[model samples]
Every structure is written in structure tokens, then in C-alpha cells.
Target chain A: MTDDTDDIKGTPALDPVISDSVELRLARQIRELDREMMPERDLWTAIERNIADYPQRKPFNLQGDWMPYGVAASLIIAIAALLVNVVGLEQRNSTLLAADYAIDSIDSGYVNVRNPMVDQFRETNKNLDQATLDDLYRNIEIMAQARKDIEMQVRANPENTKLVEMLMRVHERELELLKQDYSQPGRSL
Target chain B: MNRALKATLSGVLLAFVWAMPCYAAVDSGDLAGKRVDLSEAAKPDGFVKISIVRGDLIVEGWDKDEVSLVGTLDEKTEQFIFDVSGRDTRIIVKIPSNNTSWCCNEGSNLRIMVPKGSQVDVATVSTEVRLTDIRGGLDMSGVSGDVRIQKVSERLRVRNVSGEITVHDVDAYARIKTVSGEIDARSIKGGGAFHTVSGEIVLRDVTDEIDVESVSGDIEVIGRNISLARGHSVSGDIDLEIELIDDALVEFDSVSGSVRLRLDGKLNHKFDLETGSGSIRNRITDDKPKKSKYIRDEQLRFTVGEGDGQVNVSTRSGDISVSK
Candidate 1:
């Protein structure tokens, strides 16, 4: 063994040792190692006490959060605004449609009121003279043409109140003519 | 007994004298295309009633204090009866009771001149009746004949079934009705009811209260100082250019025809307008309308000036336009 220990510039050096037999070298290394290592003390009881004193935690849920509530509130406000707008438009449209329906109802009522008068006149004046009857019929034809013309105008303007009133007036006139002719003083119906 | 017998004989003598012809130039010959002049003494303010079956009847006011009939008769017609007694004069072109088959073909054309300020009542079937420059009330009715009256100063009542009625310069109340003939009246100082079935009614310069009703004919009224104007039409357009007097009321009702009202520039009225299924183009006000969400009809209620006059217009389906 060459000398392996050397003192270099005020520092101590260690000698290098080598072993040929594996078991004898391991025994020598084990004998040279320090064996005085110890574990820390056990605090299981204290940890258990601390854990028992602490408060319990609940499971997290997205619905219980403030952000979800804010989003839901905003959604409700938006839907309400949209509903108000829709209702306003619907009301405007319904008003116009209702007016049209009323006009049609009035026209139907006029027809109902005029038909009976016409029928009664025809029944009473069945034996009127040909010339007188022809005169009455010719005049009635003129009235009918006027009515047709008014009706055509009404078709072009369905909402014309004057046209509808004139139509009723025309019907009333026809009835009046029939009634007057049948009720004439000299006429034997 | 003697006194009673004498009284009875006197009564018989009086009856014989009354039965004699009072005025006897009663020409009974053929009067075809010939002027038959007959005059009868009458009071100044007496009444003349004329009846004809089928003929053109013309009555005019003259300065004379007598009633005269001067016109031609149809060749086929035979009898013309003129009776004047006391303050009444009656003229009739008699169609014999056996001649019931005669139409308007056989008739007379009589032009009777009555005293001024006389109440005249004339009736004819299928005869055109014309009355001019009459000072008293006129009551005339015709069937299938046109009636034209001008410058009548009293109440006028004219009725026709299928004949046109034209009245001009009527100073008193005028009531006219026709079934299928046009009624053209102008310069009517007193307003009355004008009704027509299918004939157009044109009224211009009519004053006082007027009521016009038409079934299918257009009504055009250009009235001045109209106190109360009520117009009701079924299907005819009403064109009114009216100047309402103080505290006047004008009401117009229509079913489906448009109404255009041109009010005078000095109109002070409260306008109440309503229309179904028609929009209002109001130039009267610049304010926005108070639209009801439930009722779709257009309504305008506004006051103009002091609102002394009222204008009420209602329509079922027609537009109402009012302008100054």
C-alpha cells in the first residue's frame, strides 16, 4: 500500500482504502458506519383532537353561487322586456282587425233588416199593372245599378264608412219605394 | 100651413138657381194643340187646386185677380172640367171613369195663371208640373213626371215617385221627396227635409235647418248660414261646403261613403268625429291622437275657436275629412 495520506497547504487529508473480498469489505464498511439515528415522537392523539374541533365543510354547487344568481336575474329582466314589446305589437294589430270585423257585422245586419220588407212588398203588389210595374222595376233597376256601383267602391275601400252607410241607405230606399208603390192611394194591389 | 109651403117653394127656387152654370164659356170641343183660355174671377189670396191624370201642368203667378187656364189638350182626350166658385178654383182634365186603361199617352198641357200670393195645390200622374214665381205655399205631387219650381216664396212640398224635382229660389220651407229622380235645389232660404231613394241630391246656397237623407244617391250641399244640417246617407258620398251660423249643429252619418266637409274659414265648432276601419288625416290639430288599444276605430274630438258650433260625424267604414 503506498502512502495515500497527504497534508496540502494547512489542510488534513484522508487515506484511500481498497478491499478484494466482497463480504469482508462490506463487513468492514458496515462496522465503520454510524448507527445512532432515531425517529421523531408520535402526536396522533393531538392531531385527532385538532381534527375533531374543526368545522365541517359542505359540497360545492354551481347553483348556490352568486354569479349564477346574477346571470339568472339578468335573463329574467331581458325576457320580461321582450314580452312587453311583443304584447304591444299584438294589441295594435288586434285593434285594426277588430274594426274590420265590426264593419262586416253592420253590413250583415242591414241585409237582415231589408229582406223582410222587400218580401212583404212583393207579396202585396203581385197584381200591379204591367206599365206601372215596369216603371217601378225600371227605377229599381237604376237603384240596383247605383248599389252595385257603391258596392264596387266599397270593395276597393273596405273601411269606407260613407260607402257602407250609402249601401244601407240604398237598401232602405228600395224598401221605401216598394212600400210606397204598394201603399199608394189609388193602387189596387 | 101656407107659410111652410111658401118656405119650401123658395128653397126649391134657390136650389134651381144654384144648379145653373155660374160662368159658362166652358168650351167642350176638340182642344188638341189649341190654347183654351178660361178666366174666373177670384180673390187675391185665394187657393187654386188642380188635378190631372196625364198631362204637363204649368202654373204661374200673375198680377191679375183672376184664375186662367190657357194650354193645349191631347187630341184623344175629350173632357176638361174647370170649376170656380167662391174663393176656390178647381181645374181637372177628366179621364172618364170608363177609360181606366189610359196611361200617360192621352193628356193635356195646361198653363194656368193664378193670382199672386195664392196657395196652389196640384197633383198629376205622369205629367211634368212646373210652377214659377208663386208667392204662397205650394203642395204638388206627381208620379213618373218631373217637377220644376222656381221663385216660390212660401212653404213648398213636392213628392214624386220616378220624376226629377228641381226647386230654385224657394224662400220658405221646402220639403222634397223622390224615389228614383234627382232633386236639384238651389237658393233655398228655408231648409227642410230632402229625401231620395236612388237619385242624386244637389243643394246649393241653402239656409236655415236642413235634413237630407239619401239611400244610394250622392249628396252635394253647398250651404251658407246653415243652422242645423243633418245628413244621413247609406252609400253615397257627401260633399258639403257649409258655412255654419252661430251655435249651429251639423250631424252627418254614413255607412261606407267618404265625407268631405269644407267648413267656412270663420268656423268655431266642436268636432266629434268617429270612423270604423278608417284612419283620420286630421289637419285641424297638430297634437298626437289618443289611440285606444282595444278599439281600433279612429276618433277625433277637438274644439276649434270658442266651440260655439258642433260638428258630429260618424261613419262605419268611411273616412271623414273636415277642412276650413
Candidate 2:
């Protein structure tokens, strides 16, 4: 695809062309180039044939273009709805009985609310055996079950704010278990 | 060489590696077993950590700046160590982690002595612990054993799975936890938190603010004047007989456990007691409880004799009784 001017690079006489101005080089190159390029064979006939053989796109139809867009929009809405239900409904249904003062004492134990020392504990005990890890997880499950029991009681006795406060305390214990340092030789489940 | 001979040698090596116990010290000095008199020189205000799987552990704080371990190793102990490095000391007994026979004789009964100012941390499994006269902070955990503490003047934290925990003359900030073990503390100063599951919690002569949570276990805090006290439980009765300070704040919440408070002072506190399906008995004053118009609940709110302190108690099915 390159022109014969590609050979000018290694020519000794053209070494000085590198120092020439851009306009001068362009003028000289243009003068030396052919006005038109023609193939030995008639390439226009092949071009025409290829052009006629290539398939043409169909006329624009809203059905094909809008279908994917419509599907994408519906998917976005569905996911949004699912997220709202999962998060928002729980917040709505929750009735926390503990006062902010009471909760502040328990919540201050861990700075992280969602994961709380889970990553740190796992990273610290990367060499822990499977059985030890299983024991840790089993204890966590037991605490979680206790918390779940209180939460269920909260649902049944919504009138009793005491139930709600008790649930909060149980939840705090579960968090403490999650935050326990299993890597420390002084660990106790 | 024959392949069979190599296999036998390799099997022996594997057995050795499998039985190797975990033991390490940052900079241990001297071989610590005066099993023959193993003692190590340690800093007075240093740290000591002890771990065992079973047997009795008696730790005492002494004026002498030394850490010593005196005891016989258990029959199944794969490794026994009393390591001291700089200000840190570790006394550990490791048994085979994969042993089939876990019956008795898995750890050692050892008495460890550290400087009075040295912080102590002990972890055990079914090993009874007796700690005394440690002015430094204490952190202890037990799987199933009785833990007794006396004259601990600094902060203390104890956790046990199933055993009796008794603390006497502890004047530090403390937190004691037991899953299925009874806790009895006397003359505890500087308020603390107590937690238990299906075990009784009894605190006598405890001062300062206290937080208690229990599950299916009774909680009793008797003979004290506390500025603040908070308690919560599920199916466990709570009995508090104490005097409230002028600005005291006491709150008790229970699902099915009854809450009874007896004030041993002049009546000068506001009380808010409520129950879903339980009666509220007020004996400090002659105020009749009001019934909730919306639900079948009872509410009693009264202030007596220039009420300066407040008491809030609520329950789902537990009766509330507060008296002076």
C-alpha cells in the first residue's frame, strides 16, 4: 500500500530532506507524485460489482430498535423496585424500642456497622484450619439465631418496646462475636 | 534403595511433622521450665499471656519483678512453654490438636506469678482460673471452668462458656460474660457490665453505673447505691435492691422476666413503669397505675418527694414492682 517514495528513506541523496521545511517537502513530494493512480486491471468494475453484491440495511423499524431499549428500561425499573423493597421495607417494618441513649452504649463498641472486623479477623487468621473457621462460623450462627429469635419476638410484641430493646442488645452481642479476634491465641468463642 | 524403605521413612517424617505443636516467642530468654524451677525475669509493668486447653491455672501478682510457671505438664501435652521476651511473657500448654482421646490430662495445672503491674491475659478450655491482687488490666476467657478473681484493682474482662465466675473485692471497671455459667460478684466498685445466658447473675455492693443483659437467667443486684443501671433480659427475672442517687438513671427492659426494684433511701425519684400484659405494683407512693386506652397494657408514672432521679422499667409479660 506504500508508494515508491518509501524507498527515499535509505537513499543517501535524500538524507538532507529531513532538514527541509514541511512546505518544501510537501511541494517536492507532490510534484514527484502521479496525478492519479490507475490499476493495470479495471478496478472500478470490481468495486461496482462488490458494491452491488453487498447487502443493504433494511428500512428503519421502531420494533427492532425500541425492543431492546424497552427491555433495558423495564429491567432497570425491576431492579430498582427489588432494591427498594429489600431495603426500604425493612426500615419501614422495623420498630426500634431502645432509646438513642441506650443504643449509643452498644453501638460505640465497633466503629464499623455493616462488616465490623470481619475482614480484619479473616485476614489475621488466614492460616486458620477449616475446623477452626467452622467453629467460628458456627458460633456466629448461634448468636445470629439468638438475635433472630429476639427479632421475631419484636414482631409479635410490637407493643412492648422492651422487646425491641432486648433485640438491640442481642444484635450487639452478635456484632461482638463477629468482631472477636480468632487469630489471637487468647480467643474464646 | 527399595521404595518400601523410602515410604516408611517418609511416613515417619510425616508423623513427626503432624505432631509438631505451635510454639514461638518474639525473643524468648532462657529455657522456661523449672519443671525443674522454670522462672524468667520480666518487667514489672510488662504483659503476660497464658493459654491452656485444660487443667487448673492459678495466677497471682507479686511485688517481685519475675514471671514463673510451676506445674507438671499434662499427659497429652505436646508442648509446654513459659516464654519471656523483654516485657512480654507467654506461658502456654499445647496439646495435640488432632488427638482422638480428648478425655482428661490435656493441659497442665500451673501457678504463674507476674509483677503486680503486669497486665494479664489468660485463655483456657475447662481449666479453672484463680487470679488475685493484679492491679493491672486483666483479660480472661474460659470454655468450661470456674474463674475466680479477687482484689483486682484495674480494669478486668472475663468470658466463660459454662462455669461459675466469682469476683470479690474488684474495684475496677469490669465486664464479665458467661454463656451458661453463674456470676457472683461482691464489693465491686467502678461499675461494670455483666452478661449471661441461662445462668444467674448476682452482684452485691456494686457501685457506679452497670449494664446487664441476660437470657433465661435471673439477675440480682443487691445492697448498693448506683448512679446508673441498665438491664435487659428475655425470660429472666431481675431483682434490684439499691438506693438511687439524686441524678440516677435506671432502666430495665424484659420480655417475660419480672423486674423488682427496692430503694433503700428516701423517695425522690420519678418512675415510669409499663407492661403489655402485666400488672405494675408501686409501693413507694399510693399512685394507681393507669391502663392504656389503646391496648390491654398498664402504665404507672409518678414522681415522689421532689423527684430528682428517674426510673424506667418496661416488660411484655413481666410484672414491674418498684418500692422504697
| Root-mean-square deviation (CA) per prediction | 16.2, 34.8
Query: Interface-residue RMSD per candidate?
Result: 5.1, 5.1
**lDDT (Cα atoms) of all candidates against the true structure:** 0.75, 0.75
Q: Which ten residues in a row are the worst by lDDT in model 1 chain B? A: B95-104
Model 1 lDDT per residue over A1-189, tens place: 122212222234322222234346568889998888554877788889888998577767766677978889999988887777677667655755665575567657755765675676666644443555567678767766766666665655565666667677677666666665332323322
- List TM-score per model, in order: 0.65, 0.65
lDDT of 2 by residue, A87-124 (tens): 66565455333433334444454335635466665665
Question: Model 2 shows how many backbone clashes?
Answer: 2
Q: Could you say which candidate leads in DockQ?
A: 1
lDDT for A44 in candidate 2 is 88
Cα lDDT of model 1 by residue, B14-64, tens digit:
887765444343445555446677787788888888877566888999989
- What is the Cα-based lDDT of residue B143 in candidate 2? 55
Which residue ranges in model 1 land beyond 4 Å of their true spot? A1-132, A139-189, B1-35, B76-79, B96-106, B287-296
Off by over 4 Å in 2: A1-145, A159-162, A175-184, A187-189, B1-36, B293-295
For model 2, how does the per-residue alpha-carbon lDDT over B81-152 read when each residue is reduced to its tens digit? 667778888877765554343453434677888899999998876678899988888998865668999988
